[model samples]
Target: MIARLGDTEQTLDLPPGYTLVALRELGDAFAHAREIAAEAGAGTLVWVRRYDLVEFAVVLEPDEPLASARRAFFAGMNALADAIAAHCPPEREVAFDWPDAIRFDAGLLGGGRLAWPNDCAEDEVPSWLVFGVILRAAAMAHVPEVQAASGVSLLSEGFEMVETDAIIESFSRHLMTAFDRWKERGFEAIARDYLERLPQRKAGERRGIDVNGDLLVRLAAGNAAPERNSLVDALARASWYDPQARGPKFE
Candidate 1:
């Protein structure tokens, strides 16, 4: 019923078919999850207990080749955003900034990140992949005023007061649902849902996720060759994370 990693004390009431691995408040859930992903296998959820942030990562074993399996990140993002939206107060908007950062009502609200084996070839089926999430659940004092101006926490954005555990539980269910939809329908449905959540571009431009998960941006409606934004480059480092703070950046 309960699993602990070192000094981590929190307990999470996860949904069926999940394994909760709690980390210390000071632990890095994303990094640690990746370290043990190979042995932990799929459905292992690594979580960190922080008052102002809800951080967690889940290990996944995809049967598809690494090239296409990378698209699982899109499903993770869609599920994460949907989980948060489910708990948010009425009319609160949930959106993404490109491939990784999530925004709420246009305010930076943390986002998702993913990791896979560094040396795996594109065509090889990866042994494991990790999808991590970090969300600002409460206002913090150390967040810079200017950064805070550009970003927001659920508490500051007028969201209903909700428990971090509840969010994680909801996310687990949503993630399973996302994978189900991908299986029952196709990756096209997953791609459409994830792309729809991005900050919509200008009228003439269009956007999409390629088979390999690169973001394709078209500057004009017709006769325009879309520009490719490499997902590998984009995810090399998390855009929404602050290395100094070791958590989600306010901006």
Candidate 2:
């Protein structure tokens, strides 16, 4: 069913059990979702209607501790990538840059973000967690030529007439599937799926997600110590996002 909020009309076909909260173009889905996360409960999806970008955040109530629950971020990323891949052209490749950046081929296509209460400790089960994603749906005409050229959008990447609503709907379905897989198989399955999409930085290198969601990388050659990339540290700042532009980084 469609929902109308303010002046925007929602055309999302989300799976059963999702509650829609549509926002106008100027609204911030991430922040809004966080504001209502506790009261809104899980399955609440906040979506911002914008022509040039696909922005949305979903509220989740996890049964696990905050440390491991953060791994839900990877599930969200996998869902986003799966949604994009369903419409992506044959030659285009979708990949993740460590914790939070989504890349289309070699260009940035935006990414995901995770949020929880500031008071929540690693061992504590947070009241709520929000997983948000933003992708450049189309290139803005007024953006500087240099910046436009450096960033990638669905339109620029040869996606034909793909609507913003369609992407969000697709994401909703994929997200449900991701969580289902996690419940049945475990977070390790989700980690494996996410790692498969990540581009290999070097030959003979292996990557895995730790119990606390940190990234573990080691060379296949020997017993050398695996380099640990803390998920908490990596998420502190999104690598693909530009704070000033409030979107994907162009460079």
CA lDDT of every candidate:
0.85, 0.89
> How much lDDT does candidate 2 score?
0.89
Tens digits of lDDT, candidate 2, 123-186: 9999999999989888765688877877788888888665556878899999999999999998
Candidate 1 clash pair list: none
| Model 2 / residue 223 / CA error / Å | 1.4
Residue 191's C-alpha lDDT in candidate 1? 90
Clashing pairs in 2: none
Q: Tens digits of per-residue lDDT for model 1 on 1-251? A: 48766654456777778888887778899999999999989999998877888899999999999999999999999999888888888888899887899898888888889999999999999999999988888765587667666668887777655556677888899999999999999999999999788876687677778889998888765776888989988887778888787667864
Deviation in angstroms for 107 in model 1? 0.7
Worst 10 residues of 2 by lDDT: 1-10
Error of 1 at 192 (Å): 0.9
* Cα-based lDDT at residue 40, candidate 2: 96
Q: Clash totals for all models, in order?
A: 0, 0
Report RMSD (Å) for each prediction in the order shown. Answer: 2.2, 1.4
